[model samples]
Target: MRHPHTRTTRRRVLGALTAGLLCAAGLATAAPAAPAQARAGVPGLADGLALTPPMGFNNWNSTHCRADFNESMVKGIADLFVAKGLKDAGYQYVNLDDCWALPQRDADGKLVPDPARFPHGIKAVADYVHAKGLRLGIYTSAGTRTCNSAGFPGALGHEYGDAQQFADWGVDYLKYDNCNNQGVDAKQRYTTMRDALRAASRTTGRPIVYSICEWGENKPWEWASGVGHLWRTTGDISDNWGSMLSILKQNLPLAPYAGPGHWNDPDMLEVGNGGMTDTEYRSHFSLWSVMAAPLLIGTDLRKASPATFDILDNKEVIAVDQDPLGRQGTVVSSAGGRWVIAKEMTDGSRAVALFNESGTAQRIATTAAAVGLSDAPAYTLRDLWQHRGYNTAGTIAATVPAHGTVLLRVSADPHWAANPPAAELGLDASPLLEAATPATLTSTVTDLGRTSARRVSVSLTGPDGWTVQPASATTAATLATGRTLRTAWKVTAPPGTPTGAYALTLRADYRSPAGERVTSALPLTASVVVRPPAGTSYLSGLTWLSATSGWGPVERDTSNGESAAGDGHPITIGGTVYARGLGAHAPSDVSFYTGKACTKVTADVGVDDEKGPKGTVAFEIRADGTKVASTGVLTNAMPAQPLTADITGAQVVDLVVTDAGDGNDSDHADWANASVSCGGAAPAVRGD
Candidate 1:
């Protein structure tokens, strides 16, 4: 279940004409269908649902019953499933989360779709989805009420009736929640719903995919395979790297319980939520797919960016998740933030992932024999992200970026020439740049395949207004195996460009031995920033080049309380209140361009008082990636502790807050009266 603090505000308008309207729409007056033959129970569902992990969209993470989650929005999602090629990509179900219902059930104990939200009721929505060749999924809790604060009725005691109603209404999937469960036995409650669904499926001849969302509270993996098609193995996932990584760690150990028709779900996909970078999002998608977890998208598809769609529409990666083998990838090695995971495929191949969970790039390596693949003289390595193929003598390795993953498919095949030759591309340049300043960037393309690449060419392109000029030869007549082509370009950000990260593309085009054209591209980020004026100032007054948090936006001159901006009170720690500072949640980083002018940074740091005596956090100040100051662990009971760091000659200064060993619950940290000392005269700083 999602944390109560993050629940969206519920609409309390009760539809007085719900029953009458439903009857008028013929949704309530329809006669029940005859029951079909009964199916066997236990071990797993005999109906053979969810043969592959369910792929679709669920509205809870993005909308959460907000006003936009209405009939039109749900219908629009179904339309996108067709127009955006998602339906063809194997996405089947269009699920609605909580807040789609009224505050209470109708007169006859029937669930009422909030008339304002679903004026035509759920059946109409299901019909529209089914018309688009897609399935429909609905949510309800096992307890008396749903997870939302609105306290909408659940299907606990009315399991059979509710299941029957869903079947009659054309619901093809059910996300059974665990909240408000009233201390009932986990297995018993889930099993009851499973039985009810089976009975309903027989009557309606419609098999509804059952998703057990118990949040891993009762070790559902140990018993849920026989009860539901899929079971959530973790709590609600927040749209941050820390939260995502934590959940991934929790789900990776339960691989043995998942198989075809039954899966261990690690919650929904947060790839397009905007809290994390595109690199991190790609890592999220890659990790989930390799683990064979359900790929229920949790973002508003209508407003998603092209990059989001690219990550979601990667057919190669999706194939790994939907692989008929149904083997969840297992961790082959993990140490010092480097990890190697391998999943065995049905065709005697292996899908391997080189993941970097640390703060820097690390080269992760493994062999085919190590990942359960038979030893061969040479194995074809398919880079899932690059969409290219390479041949190696059983050695598979790549330098993965921080919070990134390199996914590859390894297979020993005699017909390897049918695929494109493998080429690796890289970009070397400072990610941070000043407006209008020309920077030199180098791109290197390496031929890692067994055959040589012919007529290889490389080019760099930036945003529309930016300039990119070749500084060295960008073409090569021939590149032999194990050889690299290095090219340089002078790139300049246009004057007056906004101070934020802009995408740059480094592309390589070459011809394989069989005369097939191959293209490999790498995305790079360049942040244009303004340097601080030559003076002392409070850090909060300056615009941050980048800001990320675990729960919400980083607050200025306040405490991190909730997900909304400016929702925090004053920055209070212990018995003191500081009016000027930063209120950041644990697992946060805020960076500013200092331009080597700032000499030192000072602050009084501690866990914020708003969190009471609950949180434990540590603070660190980094100048140009070198730690200059640190605070060990400070709890809410501790007073403000003064600290200072010399940041002389540093181009960037970073304020980082991390959860101290324990989980990041209520870990709101404050940098009290944080100030930067720069050369020259003092300047006025902004404050609330």
Candidate 2:
């Protein structure tokens, strides 16, 4: 959230100009009178709904329009919400995204639930959810048909009847989408539904939380608060780091428009999706929470891992999101892929997030005074992830891993000394390891509290069947405040371990001055990687360690379209098609492990013709984080440009695509016939 003191001047100028422009464009209008208790000057429903951003489960991201998304699935989700403790964790809504209704309406012009999908009807599903102490949300479009190609009947011209039907069915939330609107004005269309919902709430005594899904094409943040409880500030989010980061950038700048009952929805949570790493998912959750966005779970709970639940069930972080102050976190400092965001809390604390967006670890730091907190001789710094409190002399700092966030709650408390003595831990070692190779891992512990600690001990543990031996002394006695201890461990991955990420835990235990035993455990991920083949190979057939795209999933040998995997045509550039290549959108990065054996990489790079003369993108090839080759800005009108890079002695290679100054719209980029030659071998020639 933007600190009111620091942003007052900028907010006044931007707010006035924005309001004036919106009113002149006829997109802004006088909002209905809010209830007496509603926050003054904020536009939203008077029904006291969505006091905090709604936490819930939505089926669209996990099982969109699938056959399994039926009555059983909906009821199962409600069951999980209770059985898995999500109910206690504050997740209340079980939403059906789309394809839950029939293609046509009944003779009375009322929407009908699909008998095939909802056997006992929508009311039964809502009742099942309500029985579990949760609310039910349903999806619809403001046009003649829903967004899905199934062409489900929408509530555009039948807003009153649809809203009434939803109320009668016990629907507690409605996600109104944009599709096939026939050129209707966005504000006029959404306002009609808002009025209808209000009337239904009066008659049925069931208020529904409204969600506006216009894809931010009309700058919904400027006019949506009066019409919806939360509004999407960007396009639909794909389960990738690039998509999440792009959406975060779009939503973070609109902080002033979100508060109390109204929020800036950057789409739903993609925490458990398989596309991104757990570290990235944690960042996704942390950033969303700090920004005060909705915490809608977008994964199947039944199939989620313990790690996924750990990220979702973080109540300390959730408290920051549900903070009654309702302030969205704003960037206090951002540069070179490092960002420091701060949110003012109601209890005179500030939630600070040190985020590392780059591809390497970075030390991000900020002062408490910089985050709108009053200065003091000492302050309390609570690590939300670690669930520990420490004393700091106003400085909040952390070495955040790539695509990770360090979330801390800082407060100038007079009783700071009453908290337990805290120690900060750090691990200085590469997280990647080859099987059966012994690597030395160093762990550092620093006393950051107000008092000294005794009997400090540190240990490193790996997965079962792996060897972990101490390389240095792991115990210390009588460590004073501000003291540091370093320990080393020789760890070896077992032979034949799978080439994937595994967990390692570094733990520290100490006796506080108050005789309380304090323990801190930090989890690290170790990835076992296998080098590429010795001969030349097409990158499309190789396994990328990680890949992220701006719009959708990265496609192999196809154009990067606006959908998930395999939803694109053959890779095409300037009307020319290629059979072997990578298709990715701008703001994309695909990394492969070469193990320092690859000699060179060659490709024909350009903006794919699928965008049809609209995209502007630049292609880059990086070897071990250093740029080895690049292309000037290329557009869809340009032919494929041949490029080659010397990747000798580079362990990893990255294929990158970036938007050229302009936005990322239609930036479908391709690396046609991309291949890497390894071990000084001759390049493999392919006929296309």
Candidate 3:
């Protein structure tokens, strides 16, 4: 693990020559780009070596420095590539990563393959690969020793000789590393080998794809196009998610520098390595394809699973990488750990991927306009994995599973035979949280895509401390293109939690349009708001109007409680009618009128909490719901403010409150001891 098989050298010649190199690229764009052959006038080397980012198998991921890199191992993989139909699918080269050469060069100063490892010699291995219609690839370091230094003399001082030997051996690719170079100038050192490769090609007429394996320290994308066919953009890539994500970040920014002949390599593909889940590997392949990175397989091909083959041999997905345009995709939008990467394919259409890196599934969306084609004419869309095709006006959306991707190919053409059958789930689900009501999130799903989804079921989840229970997802026997389903979930916030939006996730699992045999999940979050309700306690305020009719909230009147309206301070009230949480807001209405009256109706009201109202709580006793006995406005908060209304002939009353002149500012009008007596009877109204 010293340097992930290769170390990056500094940027001396590379940085200095970056500007000129970029300029030359601009001129090349005028000519038709030959993906198989485009050389920017670099001397010696021929045009078109690593056209389309060299596809083949490598031995690093499955077999490390266990001396398992013998000729037999490589030969097995090369044969499997053909047997598995990978050759027809465009996999051409079979590469050996490191420790493949003998301890020292022969006395004639030529590199040698290990006698026991390659009994017939490296040339014979090359012949074996070539006979199978596959190219042969070999590895070495620029330093005095390889990463493992398993005895082979490094190519530090023998660049020309090593390149010539590889050419003579019929090697189709050379992965030149930078192991123990003692901090040499990366551009200068790589430039030396570039010239050597050119010289070797002239002398032998064999074109070897020169891979600049100096890692990414020199920013190879800025200058490597002039020297090699491909250059490593990141150190090493692991099979896990975190490692892969970091490596992808390094490669993404260098997309513009990648073209037909030169590519930005983010290490090799770790597919079929058994290190990650199937969903993760799918995401890996999708990302690499969009980036247009090298598809060098780093796995034990002999034992690859059926799923692995399906992922690797995905032709439609592969076409995105091998597009004649050779442009790498970039993130169009990223939110909630979901990313939408878009690349324009050679066909004037686009290839987009909805990638979810979050631990849970996520609903990711992107319009045709977002990917630069909203205004284009009618187009055909294909889901690469599901192999389903359909027509679209232009927008594409999908609910991606965790660590998964929804790969799409958008073509500008309106006609096509059945390209692929793909099914997508569009679930509109979210939460509406209020302090006054129990929280519930509802998710309604509709499948309008081409394919029919099977056995759709859903589940709900939330963050820590909060409780959430989602109704079981309705099992749909066949969710055809026009079918719809819905599910609901209730959320409960733990006591003492502040008021704000919390993510409540709804996950749906179902079979794709393919079948009910395999399952996929879609996740989306509903922001559940948790805060105490505002305004008067239902018990304190008599029967009132609806929420829209100025019926404010009723919350606990505690210290720091939101008893005031529009986010104000708490209020204090001394009354048995209201509970721990009480809210009294002005601009409110209540009625207590019935025609049977008492002597006088009296009540003592104070500011609900300290954040008292600026208005007065006036009582109007009426004979028929009309105002008779008036208390006017009691705006005093000192001592005792008693409001008495003479019942005389009034059998009913109307209690209306309003903020003085300041709209509803400080409208925390608490009407304590509020009553409407009839014949020495209690106020005929009570609130909960």
Candidate 4:
């Protein structure tokens, strides 16, 4: 059972829905016994259903229940699923998400369909689906409520009864969800339902596909095999590239756990969701197909245009999902945000997807040598989406679009064929980082693509005063590109080392992958402030700036630091600066830290300082020009005063201090020596 805090909340809700139905149908009415043994020749639920890619239509991305759902929508989609050849293409299930069930269970302890929309009853809906030569899929949860706490009588204590009811309704597929089940033991909670589903299937003699949906909690791969067929390995996916990539990257390391009977479900596809451009959607489909994920479409099938229809109907791409090899792709290489390599099936051929995750377009080419196929057979290539043939002499090459991918099917050209030996060089890290002082340096070794290096040496550097530990010189072995080696270093900053700015550097060695050792570095970062937890405002600002996403960090130790770090003091009229990202040059508003009860004072501070990506250095002051506060040079430091500013009962306050080059009073002009604060009902500066 997935709690709301799990990575992907919505998918867990679906998992709960599936499990709850089985329990409702009467399995495990009492406490569980030991794990049951399988009867000879009895197929696992996953084996009987969902043996291939799970074909279904979900209501998240394309619909989201923003509008009133009706039988027309359901029947229309069922008609489209068949009319559009999707059912023939192997898509056979239709599942609804939240908002379909009523707020209360009926007298029979059975969840009643909504009277307004599901007037015909859920069983009637199931019959409608079955009449179309398709299967009916319904949603529910392990908890007593749904995602929004709407009532939908769940399987919390009545697993057996609920499972029996769903079985009686002729429900062919169940999407168990996870929601509102917090404060309960997740594993035991889900396990109880899994056992119930097993018992329900045995008693009813009906096969129900078990979907474990805890948003990958308790590491689904660790226990999902015995519980469900397909486990949601990540949060619900949105109709954007980042959402897709984030989910995909999370599933890479869990590849070994996926097999023919089980899979790493990376949520559903947003192919025709209208949130992304067509090119991005094509890339999205290619990536998911190459990953061998469940191909559940979250689009309004009835409205799918020819383009959408064509992409979904691409048999070549679909072949990758139904590959006989039954192997899920794993990420072979990653450079954080730059590139990735994933492998899958190519209809008896091999499909490799080389992706460039950068902002600008990147040309990525790999010889059979780099990816371990040095002397493989001559090959024919075809771009899956383009449906065009590609002829390669020896090397396969393509320019991946920005935030895009190139899917290639590799097989013998028949003109030339040969077997090649696999290349050998590996990389691994052990306890990658350990305890160190505030400014200690650490190192990790790398293996080169080549075997040896004539002058193999490594360097450790990051932030200010990074020192190589003990001895810095060693006659090291030639490090392969993916090989691992350790380096030790210490970071020592002199008293004069600035306290505000931090540094990040890369440790590089003069070692090349193929054999020629060259000095290339890996990047590292060192910071002065406490690390902010992810998603906090401070971290969001910093991460955005570091990515050069139009934001820059301020120089805390400089004159312009006042605005970035200042506490509210003497009344200022116009504006006060806090942090500057974009909109600095553009007209903007400022916030002030006013003490608890500071009364009113009318004034405006003319914040005229503007600088680099960090923005301008200026300040805001009271109209009378008596009180002055300044936004100093760009820096990353928090002000000595509280962030909020207050101005009450004060007639005059001057907040602007001229930049050093502005010819203002030198005493206030130099930010390095300026330490301004207010007393009493004033905002006080604790540090200079």
Instruction: Tell me the whole-model lDDT of each prediction, alpha carbons only.
Output: 0.82, 0.83, 0.64, 0.52
Writing each residue's lDDT as its tens digit, candidate 4 over 11-112 gives: 345556555554465533565563445322233434455566577777666776555466667778888888888888878878776667777777777777
Arranged by TM-score with the best first, the candidates are 2, 1, 3, 4
lDDT of 2: 0.83
Ten contiguous residues minimizing lDDT sum, candidate 4: 544-553
Relative to the unseen true structure, what is the Cα RMSD of model 1? 6.8
Question: lDDT of model 3 at residue 390?
Answer: 59
TM-score of 2: 0.80
The regions of model 4 sitting more than 4 angstroms off are 1-35, 38-46, 336-340, 344-348, 369-374, 413-579, 582-688
What TM-score, over all chains together, does every model reach? Answer: 0.79, 0.80, 0.62, 0.58
Q: Which regions in candidate 3 have their CA more than 4 angstroms from the true location? A: 1-46, 149-151, 374-378, 416-441, 447-485, 489-688
Q: How far off is residue 521 in model 1, in Å? A: 3.4
Local error of candidate 4 at residue 228 (angstroms): 0.3
* Number of the top-ranking candidate, with lDDT as the measure: 2
Clashes, model 1? 2
The TM-score of predicted model 4 comes to 0.58
Candidate 1, residue 669: lDDT: 86
Name the lDDT of candidate 1: 0.82
